[model samples]
Target: MIINTTHHNTEHKQIIADLIGSPFSLLQKFKMKGVGSKRMIIDKVSPNMQSMMNKVSDINYANIELRPKGILVMINQGLKNFTWIIPYYQLTIYKVNGSSLHAQGRFVHFKNNKTFKENKKFFDKLLDEKVRYDMLFAMPQGI
Candidate 1:
């Protein structure tokens, strides 16, 4: 399951526990630490999905070296099964400009071409060709 929490309130904690079993377990494995903040988690994914994440990580590191902006792309596979293939994804861009940090993100159902195209355009404009190309091919359809 994928979990996106903007607040680490009581309700949020309870929900996370119910969904994932134990917060401490996640923390132990991922070595994550946050008292109160927004968090996004991908509980489990297929090997293919894990490979895509590695590609995104590589792109993120490369972009950091070349530009002030960096983008992280991820596919979230939920716990429930889908009759047809479902591609739920999110992209987040983090920019550093002379001591200031800025970020923008979008979540989309990957079957939507319009949304996918829009995101591709934004990333192409903000990132390098290599990063864009990697992202394009990382999709399940290999677009």
Candidate 2:
């Protein structure tokens, strides 16, 4: 899944539309299971999935031609036989010339029925000094 801090807008929507037009691609659907909030689910209907996809679609569409800038904090793991159980997180900041103005969020390598909170502490710590410092320090001055 793709994640970005930018608000979902028209430009981003176009990018998603293009990706959806491609073959052998699937879009994730967000559904509300309870009163808490909505969560993403894999959708089998191709066109419908593409049409409904948001967030990531918006991010990619908006910055389709932009080169990656700033620092990207990525957490990845390789699970041998059980590849699906691996958990990964990536946060990317897209810069405009000299300053960061866009960001994307991602989570992958999750197994079926897996829960994020199971690794919340680890994820939180990464978001804290470890990941935060890395991103901030890696950026060029004025970015």
Candidate 3:
């Protein structure tokens, strides 16, 4: 689900929380080592998500924040902010030419630039979280 979070909206907050679980407590965040990624330059986005990017700007930037059961991909457009909520089961990430995050038929590609290199550890942490979440539903070996 994508929401315009430039302003504080109670309904939006509730929806996001229900979709991906709530934000982690300070202690949880501390144990996770960190739950956010450094800013990254966006290289491209799925055609359906073109509107979320600023066409006028040559470069777009985004960052990711880890949630208990999912992750939030936050895109900035001038003064406006858009967030894409992706649960662990629905999220797909790839690192071909650069980093690509896809969910709900939309995707955003982050350039493999300096900023992306700086976020290597964060990406690893995200994958680990996803694996942990998925294990909760693992089937029995003989089932």
Candidate 4:
């Protein structure tokens, strides 16, 4: 399934994926957080560009979008079971390096071209970086 052709569209959208593990299977979870996650069809870029780009760490993501409600994830499938929506706040992007992302204690890496800057422009419209990004990307210091 990993080798399937990427579905591209002129429509702006960002799909988050990991190169380390099988990111395609992210919709299914081994453990439930109790909050309950939903699957929706999403194919739009984030309105707040800086809100997402500020979390960048050198490596680029397959796609990462910030929606009005939460983080909208894109899935390559039929209309019935397509997208996975994870609350933006619940998704704690703690660490991002190489092609890997440590979000909410789960390791997720990019499975597509990782040219961070170029990819960002290709996905979303870039806004200024003056916005306060501390609270969003902040992780627990230690136990």
Candidate 5:
């Protein structure tokens, strides 16, 4: 779900928390080292997501925050802030010329540039967390 987070609306907050789980506690944040991604340059976005990055600027950027059960991709377009909520099971990542995150028939591609290179470690952590989350529901092979 994409929501305009420009204001601190209680309803939006509740929905986000319910969908991705709440933000990590201080201890969890410290233990995890960090739960956020370095800023990334946006190269492209699915048609439906175009509006979120419509404002012309020197660069369109986004960042991701990891939650217990999912991830939030926050995008800023001028004064408006939008977040794309994607649960672990619904997330799909692909690395082509650049990296693209896809979910719910929508996708956002990040340019494979300097900023992206700086996020190598964060991406690794993200994939690790996703795998860890997936294991919790893994069925027995012989079942």
Candidate 6:
């Protein structure tokens, strides 16, 4: 999702992309039947993400959106310690598999990349909605 090239921060963008790319995303998909939505304070991170976060500032969570009592993520528009807000007008989001987004950075690979590949429908549903991507926050670097 290359939106604004004017300000670029590769590591920061990778962190946000990694979050979306990580199996953590599926944690929301198979949410317990009636569990309520709450803020996400992700302290323990995957090895891949931890390695990536090390290159940036101290990680934390923030609710940039005005959604009350909803889950929040720690990211900014390619900056340290900011909430990520996807710019729908300029960027297109995709779900790709593997440890991170595809090298080309268009499609998101989700096959065999989730905590539970047992459910193929979840996988298909993710890809099927490419046209209606969730407003994933796109963080441009060099802020």
Best by TM-score: 3
Alpha-carbon lDDT, every model:
0.29, 0.26, 0.93, 0.32, 0.92, 0.33
Error of 3 at 106 (Å): 0.6
Instruction: Output the TM-score of candidate 6.
Output: 0.24
Span of 10 residues, lowest total lDDT, candidate 6: 63-72
lDDT of 5 by residue, 32-90 (tens): 99999999999999999988885656588899999999999999888888999999999
Runs in model 5 with CA error above 4 Å? Answer: none
Task: Give the count of colliding residue pairs in each prediction.
Answer: 0, 4, 0, 3, 0, 15
- Candidate 3, residues 1-143, lDDT tens digits: the string is 88999999999989989999999999999998889999999998999989888879568889999998999999998888999999999999999878999899998999988999999999999999999999999897884
CA deviation > 4 Å runs, candidate 4:
1-62, 77-81, 99-107, 111-117, 120-143
Clash count for candidate 2 is: 4
RMSD of each: 17.4, 17.4, 1.0, 15.9, 1.2, 14.0
Q: Cα lDDT for residue 128, model 1? A: 49
- What TM-score would each prediction reach against the true structure? 0.21, 0.21, 0.96, 0.31, 0.95, 0.24
Give the lowest summed-lDDT range of ten residues in model 5. 50-59
Q: Write the per-residue lDDT of candidate 4 for residues 1-143, one digit (tens) a residue.
A: 11222445332233333312223233332221111222211212234222222232432223444333344433333222223344444444322332332334343443333244334432222111112233556677889
Flag clash pairs in model 5. Answer: none
Candidate 6 lDDT (Cα, 0 to 1)? 0.33
What's the lDDT of the predicted structure labeled candidate 1? 0.29
Off by over 4 Å in 1: 1-69, 79-112, 128-143
Model 6, 13-44: lDDT tens digits are: 55544443322334554552222222222333
Query: What tens-digit string does per-residue lDDT give for candidate 1 at 1-143?
Result: 23333234686445434432332344542432221112123222334334323333222111111111222222322322111111212223332221111222222223223333334433444344335545765847554
| TM-score, cand. 2 | 0.21
Ranking of candidates on lDDT, top first: 3, 5, 6, 4, 1, 2
